[model samples]
Target: MRPTDIETLVQVGRPTIAPDGAFAIFATSRPSIEANRSLSRLWRVDLPAGSPRPLTRGSGDRAPQLSPSGDVVGFLRPDTDGRTQLFVVEASGGEPVQVTDRALGVMSFAWAPDGGSLVFVSPVGERGRYGDVDGLGPDAESPRRITGIRWHANGAGYIVDRPTHLFVVDTPDLDAEPLVSPAPAVRPEGAPAPTARVVPNEARALTSGELSYGSPVFAADGHGLFALVSEIERDRADLRSRVVEVSLDAAGASERVVVDRDANLTVDDLIVTPAGDLALLASSVGDSGTDFVAACIGLHVRRDGAWIPLTDPETIDLGDPGSHVTALADGSFLAQSRTRGRVQLIRVTADGAIEVLRDDVEVTGHAATRDGATIVAAVADVTSFGELELVRFSGEGVGRRITALGRTPIAAIPSEREVAGRDGYPVHGWVAVPEGEGPFPVILQIHGGPYAHYGVHLFDETQVLVAAGYAVVYANPRGSAGYGRAHGRSIRHRMGTVDFADVIDFLDAAIEADSRLDGSRVGVMGGSYGGYLTAWTIAHDHRFAAAIVERGFLDPVSFAGTSDIGSFFGDEYVGVDPVEIEAQSPMAAVSLVRTPTLVVHSELDFRCPLEQATRYYTALKRQGVDAEMLVFPGENHELTRAGSPRHRVERFEAVL
Candidate 1:
């Protein structure tokens, strides 16, 4: 499973249920390692038959959405300039018809309730940031600045012009119409006022300004649109987001919040049940690591003007646990939980009684059919390819395989382990061992969110390292999520101290427990916070033979100024001002580094920013420490997982 072998593992994403519940539409990537391109295709699975058929051919097909009538499927295809446009095809299978002309990139799209039209969001060219001219007037067009499309390198890339407003198009005639328009603010008589043409028949902005609304879902009755609104602010990773109900009739109408933002909870995947209740996936990080346990799947019933949690929090760990809940027509919910490297699909009754539906297969993505007789889920094993599986469950709780919708190999094997860290605390970790053994080199992998966990699930990079003859160990130190709020918050003001001690302790314990690990030639790698730790470890301890710091924090003070979330980190995680920044910075301590280090980052990564790496690389070179810097063009902090295929491959090769 080395980076080179990533081609064999098809990456699946954007799973959508078809109208009749007989099948599901999903997008998967076919990585051509030889050509250095990962081609994505659209696929559909028949639920009762458990068979899948390819809907699109060639490269760059993704974001497939099934029409409400199940008669057609819409998706995005790459154009000549690498921009993507909307296309549609018959659900039964046929040639795809390009619906939108290739111009600007299509960021996201949603089908109209009647299946006769669709609404999509894209950037307007030249009028604003990224050339997005969607809702701007003639006067505002020249300035080329849109409300949401501010370009500050890190923060700028995330901002889109005009806040990703919604636009609708009639499918039959391909006549584009504005559903929501940008709000115009009244200025003083002497002050300058922006002017933009109001396109009466074109798409209009539903909401305006700094806040963004997306993941739109039409209510079962088609009376309103349910979308997640992300309210952006200056200094916080915890942006205020909630489910908002917007009226489809009036473009400028105010939206009502269906779910309130709690300090611990973040909402995702909003859906309205057939019974007229709204359900959303809620994720929460508690006060400490122990309190940080998540409810993998929850059913929120809109009762008495508020959404009530139907699922008990104690029964599931939802934070990165990969639990999915699909609503059934019978009023029950299909809840799938991946526990300790195993996946189980359970049927949760409205009253909370849980019944096992199909416990034999590892269900990743699942959807309940309209008839409620069969459940379509994506299943796969470590060696088996990924495929859409249809399982018919009887009233007696028995399940029978209906069909093998699509076949895809399991990209990797996920396993869990517990090791003792410093102070005798239990630290959890995931280990992916290579096929062969002989004291193979080991990699001490650390997660980015010193607050995030190394869960029991499949990971592309872990498999890649394992396949490269490296035993990979990713641990949840004192500050990883899923343990509880206390555990997660414990790393605050103690970065590079307790967490680093935990890493050392875990490595010592792991090497002592396993003979396959060659501790003497170990490599350490991490990004963001993990990157900060990598640099700190090599400087403070000489145990690691080599290190790769990807978009990592080197100087805390500089990071606080440049990082997109820097203000949040300074106020929350480190709590260090300009005076103490250098004291806690790895670059300030770079003189002690002895291990050979590889500094890899993306030029566009405003999160860590290449400057952090440049500062360290220069210091290390000045101190005569062995180090090199590798920068990927036009990539951000997420380059390791989402960068160009060729660059991503090169990164892994350099690190391994």
Candidate 2:
């Protein structure tokens, strides 16, 4: 084993198991040196034997899902025009067939109930072309006319021209190939090489109009199609979504089913159980003077056309609100939840009993077997990346590891520790120390999402820092997820102050415990909320020797005006008053900072916007502080993680 370098770390996407649980398929991505980008390919692994092989050798294939019949696997890949389209190949190796050829390309898809067709979502312009360069064909270089508040997204640039809609494409049944072969492609030589039928996979628009529809789920009976539809609102920030049902063959007629008692709630996920019950996760929007917080995930079940609460109203939030639930037979569901700074598999029984199925490792992706007795999950820990594994419900949740996949980046496991905080709250964290080192420079890494946490999972940046002979330390502050709602929302009005103290306390405690850590040579770095705190730390305390702030906010008032989520973020995260926001801003105290800082920003980042970096850099220069700015072109806020491979390597190099 070798130390995991920054560039070679492979990324894993969704992993779906076959219906019979005989095999599983997943997407693997690696940075391409020639293209200066990332390329993904689909791979398959036989169960029990765990013999893994490449299923599709394409430039970028992702989102692998096995059909109900388990004969074919469907994935998304780009066409010649750079549009991502749906592709299907035999579960047994063969040439993949392009299933959909829409103009804009498919975003995501689900296998139809009969497995003869696929329901997919594609972004289309108002005039019905699939994002065809403002309906002027694929090669048109036209001016982007922005019309609304939510016109552009961070990573996905301009989105107002084309709102994503639902469409269904018919697929041809594949012939079964012999599963056992001597090699990857062992077809009989000169035996009439099999050719894919050139079928017309013209997609039909299932739903139409200006509003967007997503998370399309088919009824168990295959008659009704349910999805979350967002209606056009005067207030662009108000994403008041509801569960709507439409006939699978219908084209625009949809009936809303109130999943939330209050229509002001945002319906994130929708799933149709085997029993025809509509299970959805809804989050309430605070309207009164109370500080808006992430309330308990409201699990609703629609019975007899009326939605009713299935889980207790006060049910503990399964931690990660963005994680979807996989419904099992008899109405029970499995969800990936965060607890105590680690990812766990949580099972919500039909009667609403939440049980921790797997508590030791990070279960990133999972799929249920046809019998619903077993789950094939992609599990990873701090020292390793994702690998396919089988987890039986009858066991103690410590499933059997199946495929080793690729080499793990971490040569050694990170050590876990806890620091006592206010009111007996324990701040949990992990530290990865480099080998052959004494009093190493410490890189205090912070995670984003203020609501998202860093735990016992494989983080590439942390490994990269450790591999570079730096001691990496990260902890879950007061505002991170995995803890209950109170802890997650504790930094709502006090984002920089409370969370800053928690991190400082944890860092000091860690330094006190380890004699080989050079606390005086400490550098702080973070993205998004972590970036916000990084700037906050340099402003308040001058202990940090260097700082790297990636896509972070410096002025709350300017951020509230420029960010896509600016409309509601101030009301939700920070205090609404202008005076308080200015006081909390890092820009307000630039004269007090005396540390070398690196400001990284993306050109297309609409979340925090490029102004954040520019303003912060301007202040650093005006104050005559040591500062350098790196502006990534053709990238967004997710530049560090999902940007081009060459860029990711350069980012680490710059930070080092």
Candidate 3:
């Protein structure tokens, strides 16, 4: 496990079981150095035997799904036009046939229950009242009208004129060649075949208007689709989302509101069960200190005709950071969530009982069989990379791993340790020591999210650091997810004060417990929120030898005005007022830093933005402090983790 071997690792995702439960298909991505990009391909594994092989070739192939009939598998791939179009191949073996040839590309798609067609969402240019598209194209260069605060995203870029909408395409007829093309059709001078003139069952738009749809899901009976839509006014302080039911048969039809937006709740990730019951993940939307930025699973039973909150808002979290849900045959739902420091699967019973199904490993992707008898998940811990694991559930909410699919051998594992925060709250962390060492130089890495948590997962950055002969220390402090709501909410409105103290306390505990860590030769580094802590730590304390700050907010005032989520990030996380945010900003004391700092930033990172790094570096240099800056062009905030393998390795080399 050398630092350069990071490029050779195969990252697996979306382990979906086939309809018949004969095998499983998943998305695997690895770096292609020749192309200078990551190639994601689909792979299949025999169910009981767990023998693995490639199912699709080339790059940009992802989101593979075995059709309901179990004869064909559907996936998304980029065509010659660079637009992601639907493609399907025989379940046994054959060449894949291209389906839709849309210009903007399909963002997401789901197969119908009856296996007739697929409902997909793709970006469409904004249209006038008369339904004429305003001038927008794949190569059009024009000024985009700026009207909304959340108009541009970090990775997605400016989304002003183009918005995503829902459409349906027949998958069966997609294999046949079209009857007409630019080359001209063989028809008599005056006689023309009407239906034959156009491709049969052409893609139809089921949704329209100035709105955006996310992850549309088909109903169990295939009558309609349920999806989260952003129809509320964008100028509002907080963006609102609600679930809408779209009719598959009607064009430009009125959609029914399945779940209306509540004053304090943001609902998303809608899933429908075989019983027709709707389940959604909802989080509290507010600037209150106890606001639940992380959502919990909510259930809406059709029989009762009302939505009921399944998990406790203040006590239970969704185990994971994002909103995700999977419905079962018996009307129960499974979601990835964290309890203390490990992300696991939790089952929300049909009767409203919350139980932890598996709690030892970090489950990233999971899918269940139609009958809910077996489950397959992509799991990993501190010791290994993500691999497909067979999971079985029994009575009383207990689960066990049956087998590992394509498991990668690990060289070393981190030792878990518990330390008390300055306020006496328990903080969990892991320390990775080198093979032969005494008082080794240590690198303390803090995780971002201030809302996100670091679990027992195999973090590449940690592994690479350890491979470079440096002991790495990572932890889940206060404000991290998986330890319940109070633990996360504790850092809200407090920011650098509480979490900073927790990090210092954990470092002291680590130094006292282990004799191999060199307490005097320590380097600090972090990204996003962790970046904020690093800047703050070096400013307040002078013990660090070097510091690395990657895409972190140095000034809350500038961030509140420039960041895409700036309007609400500081107000909700730090405080409701601008004054409170300014007081807690790391920039307030950045001039006090005297350590050699290396600043890493992505040019296109709209979340933290490049100005954050530039302003801090300029300040540090002006103070005559030893400092350097590394800026990655055309990259976003995720550069440290999901960026190019070349850049990731270069970042580690610079850190060392």
Candidate 4:
């Protein structure tokens, strides 16, 4: 049930299906304990006879894209200074040709249908203006300056703004040009809609106003484009987003909404079905859990004025709900379902009946070819290392499996147990004991988002802590996501009340049950809301010997004014108004802290800024509670996943 010892889990990303459906390309990183450090390589899988083969051997290759014609593969690679640039290689696997040599970072790119061109988005300068919200003064000349009215005022505190629109590249020669030019003028309040105009090399404007749009997909007929438009309304509980279709032939365009609602829903993946309908994968915050639910993933036909859903939501979640559906050229579709925490590939008839095609392998990421017969899936299990598998299916049944890429084993099975929470509710958690047989120091690790769940995904940080000779205990308390709506919403207006007690109760039970856990040598660590919980626990109880709070909010009132999702957090998580904020904020209760703690924050993180960490650090120091602060430069809320490789390693080392 458990690995011999804990090791770092390799990070995998950007899995894309090949045109012929015979294979997939993806990026994988080696495990490292250092902060802000990463080394990734590109790999390809062949569906029938062979395992996946490495296409690029060195570090910094990522965001793999298989060309439309399946003749070439493109990805981003690090240059001399470590900034990423685009590179392309032959489908047969050979030397890669560098495409872009820009000083700014190139994070993403897509191949054009004709295979002679591509489109990409990257930072414009060495110090990009993308995420800068303060606006450049006279001396600031960087193109990465953050714009867009709503983002400017909300100040999500990101180091870089979203890239400046889309850009197109002519292949072979590889020259790039912005797709939308002249940047639409900022319209005044209540102003009449301006006359639509098209700029050369730029796509027609689909939506107006200062809000931003991205994730563009060309229709099957290539006559229209589907893009996601975000509108940030002042004082709104959540950011408003809608999918709009725009005409490609006309200079002026009209848009029709594909998905629109009051809740926060962001499109994650989209593809045109072989039947000429749109299939999409979206993430939304619903009443149940965080609603990471997969939508139709089949087909949505346009009818009357709106697009109608072809696949039923009930059916999508029935056999396998969270799995994505991919359309095949022959009109049949591939549906992936999660059965008992493992993913299975199922072939669905046009009428909606499904037959399990592949069930033995554990599938994570999936991509289908133009024909449904072949599938590229990422497969891994408790003992198996991460790898991309090329799976072929035919009239007979599931076809042969070919390895596409291999990853080092990075996860360990911590002992699983069910403990009683403060309210006597059964809480499930994992306790990863260090290598030594005798009692080891314990670290109470908490997950962030408050509404998110820590599921069966191969997590690296947990293994890292275990390797550091610390017994790590991570639990799903009442408010954690994935359980159901009632459980997740339990801590809404009672942040420090029940949830806090749940952690204490769980730890008490765990220490009593496990002799390998040293109760007196315990420490606590968490990020974002988890950080808030860590701060709150140390202030209210003296059970912990040391604590680390990463980018956590200390004052609900100040957080409401500064955090990007302030309105939503204030209205739902904590009760509205300054009174409730004061009652729930850990900073407001700083006078009670008596435990040693470490405060960590990123300078550019808008979610929970450095000020929040500083406030807690200052309070603990002044109150004679030992404390220290660590700040990461040019990092955002995603410091753990996307920050500079070196800094990420440092942060882990400091806390450990």
Candidate 5:
């Protein structure tokens, strides 16, 4: 693997099964180096065992949703103005007709249970803002009067100025031109124009106000909908969200239900069972807004108008916030669960019974037939980058591979292992060793989310280093997801103690386990949380000869005001105590570092912000320690994963 290999990687996700469980459709994306962006398209595959074929031209298509009746598939694609809009196409095959022409891009959309109409979430700002008209950008807009803590975000700036609201679009009217123009140029005089089924454009907002709403699912009768609502306040400086049910009747609607009562709850994924029970992944931000700081997300179900805990809040992690969850026909729920290092599909009943349907596969996104018989999942592993895997409970064995999106770029599979921590606790991790007889230079890499873990997957970063003749070792320490709650919450207020020791323990054990690893020439490198650990490692123990800290959260003091999630991140992850925060910060102990360091950061990274890298690098240089700084303009904390193709290549080269 090389830096240029980033362009060849293809990612597929959001698999949805058909009503009869005979076919499925999923989205595929590949980065175009020439265009410096990722191009996405939808693909359909016959279930059980079948070849995958392109359904839509690979042109910005994403988030495909299969309608209730399975007569059509609704997806989001860019309009003429590059704003994402709702689109629908025949289940058999044909051109997709645009269903909306929202001023701003559509965030997400779902079909009504009865399949008569669809509901979408979009920013309902005041007219003239966010390109509402033909030609208007932020430069032409007036200043904003900020009153919320979530006024600005990392990638999407000034979110509070135009709160996102929900609107309903019905398809009653089918022979007219599309609500939004087609992506390509207008047809010639003799050519035909696509017709959208009968329906007016967006009628009106079903919801409005300061709070933002998302993850909406329609009721079985299509008379109401359930959505997650976020409420931000000024005093506590934390984000609090809950689930609510709203009457779908635009006029004379007066009923609303607040589903969850836990304060400081961050709702991740929400699903409504066929029995109408609610299952969601959420974590309560304990009293100090830091109680469950580093713990994995827990699963909860609504019973008798009260939220009931289903999965163990500490140990069982049900993927990330936006991970997909399907409600089965028998009242059982299907979801991708994170355990140890693998994300496997699990079946959870209304009474809290869990049965693993698929194991040893990293389930990224999944959808199951309401019967819980046929399951289609997007999986990634050591040998495969990303592809679709099918699993059938009605069959005798695990389901077969359903799609091969692209060629696999990984040259060798990483060896997984578990080593003992300093305190005798077992630490799980993996190592990718280059093909050679002699000892290779080592790179001990750390993962970003102290909560995020290194799993069995084709990671471009480690692959490139190993291909360049370096041994890369990474581990999921005490503060990582997968393992149970005790492991994830072990490092809440103590960032660099046992967690740091667990990482060091893994690195040392890997070097000792394999003779190919050179302990003397070891260097440390990581991004975000990994970056902080890299700086912290060098500051305390100068075992490494060099270091690269990219977008590290160095000082919690300044991070409270600068980061997009700064309102409660610093106080929640680190501590509110000034002394403990400073003592644990990598920047405060910069004087002890002697390793030659290279500090990397994204200029617009609101997560860690550029100040973290600047402060650490400047302090190292001021103290006469060797240090260098490299900053990428217009990039955020997701630079490595979603940055421009050329910028991604440059970042890999920097690591090399």
Candidate 6:
């Protein structure tokens, strides 16, 4: 595939099935190289089996949730003002009506159990913090005071001032007609001032505080909500949220904590089952409140005021998107589980018996029925991009692919390889070779998230390099996720030690196993933690002919202050000691590097920060080694994945 093929690629968001399983609607988005923004539209499938049709035009539509009776679909879309407001359209079809007009915009929302009203989480702060209350723009806004560590996010700008709160919006009758303009003139007799029977499109705050709230799910009674609450103002640290019961009444603002926060726990998501049981996905934070290195996210079910742990945290690491659970008819729940690079469905019974449903294909997004008869998921194997597949809960094969919209056909099949570390641990990876290759020069790519794993999917990085007459080898060595907590924590304090060994061991094993890979012409490259490892590899091995380090966490000391999660990220992964931190950093070994290197960075990348790539590139140049730096403006660490279409293609070109 060519670099421009990035635009041809399509992504499917989580599918939402109607309560009765009559149809399914999901959002499909693709990056537009020319527009330089993600384009999205909602598509609906008349269920059991039917052709998918466009449901709503694109305004970056997202989170399409069906109303109680499944007649209207409520989703978030940017209003004319460019703030994400709630919109609803008849499931059958029609122009979506804007149902909400909030200044700060909706972050997440849930329909009331009765469907008459919906609760959304939106930022509530004094006017002008977001924009002036008057017609003036941002330049007329008031000054802000500095506060909090979690004040801003990587891609999102300063957000500490606008703490999110619960807001309930009563839905206007779908059949209601447009109101007459300016209202009729009042008669001399004053017939109720000629009032218009118009339903308000405004929302009322349900709860108010400096704390931030999100993932609102209405309580079964419909008079309350269960929202994930983060004590950001109370504790300025890595967001640790707890589940609470939020009352809708004015006198009910006093929240009853359902699931209290624990130093060992960080809530990921929360949802109510058909029986009103609250199920949550959370990961262990250890005692440090930030021991976040490759922590496993497990499932928890709260029934009748008693919360029960469903999966063992150390052994079961549910994929991030997989945490969304669909309650089945048999008192069991269906959620996604990640193991060995493949994310598949797993059934968790109320009693905590875990059963793997499918393991052959990785499920990127999914929706299931209450009866467990039908399940729709975005599935991708080694050679294909994600395609919507309809599968039975108790399926035998890949049930059936329902939509051909997101499929990206592969030109060459990927070969999976596993190797043992020198200390006798397993390392996994994949090798993609070009069609006409004798002994192709190899590009050894490493993934970020020492905790994130490489999986069987249409990874463009490997596909693009292989198309350019270079064999691409990438792997999930030690410190990668989907391999249980032990494998992830194995490299916590030993950053570039065994993890580096596993990467090298896997590369060597791949060369020995595949005849098409040229071991002598090897080039190493990685981003984030992978970038750190890449620099360390060149400095320590001196065998690589070239290296490309993008967004590497080179200097731990500097990272501890600049990175968004740097406050505790370094203390957990590396060490708190000044000497030990330096010793473990890749920057310490940069003087030994002799390989030609290309340092790629995004100007707005706050995760690794721009200084990371710049520092590595400067060190290489000073040492008299060939080096070059490429920086993309208005981009972040997610440049390779979510950057502009043109920039992504340019990155591929630079890699070549």
lDDT values, one for every candidate: 0.67, 0.75, 0.76, 0.64, 0.80, 0.80
Q: State the TM-score for model 6.
A: 0.93
Clash totals for all models, in order?
A: 51, 0, 3, 28, 11, 1
The better candidate by TM-score, 1 or 6, is 6
lDDT of 2 by residue, 1-656 (tens): 22215445566666887777677888878767578777889888887566779998897999988888888888999988888988889898798877777777788888877898888998886553345345567455556665555666676766766778988878755553422323345678776655443344567788877778888888888766788776434444665566677676454445656453245556668877777767777655555422336554556665666555565543355436336678877678887766776667777887778877677777777777645676777777765666666777433344777766556566447899998966566888888888875688998888898778787767787877777788888999988877777887888877787788888888888888998889989999999988888999998888888999889977788887788777777667778877777767787777788989999988889999999899889989998999999998888888877787677777777887
| lDDT score for candidate 1 against the true structure | 0.67
Across 39-113, the per-residue lDDT of candidate 6 in tens digits comes to: 888999976679999998774998888888888899989887788988888999887777777777788888898
123-144: candidate 3 lDDT, tens digit per residue: 8865441123456444555456
Per-candidate TM-scores read 0.80, 0.90, 0.91, 0.76, 0.94, 0.93
Give the Cα error of residue 346 in candidate 5, in Å: 0.6
Question: What's the CA error at residue 455 for candidate 5, in Å?
Answer: 0.3
| Pick by TM-score: 1 or 4, better one | 1
* CA RMSD, predictions in order: 7.7, 6.1, 3.8, 8.8, 4.0, 3.1
lDDT minimum window of 10 residues, candidate 1: 288-297
Ranking by TM-score: 5, 6, 3, 2, 1, 4
Query: Residue 273 of candidate 1: its Cα lDDT?
Result: 69
Better of 2 and 3 by TM-score: 3
Better by lDDT, candidate 6 or 1:
6
Model 3 alpha-carbon drift over 4 Å, by segment? 126-140, 174-201, 231-234, 286-305, 319-323, 393-411
- In candidate 6, where is summed lDDT lowest over 10 consecutive residues? 190-199
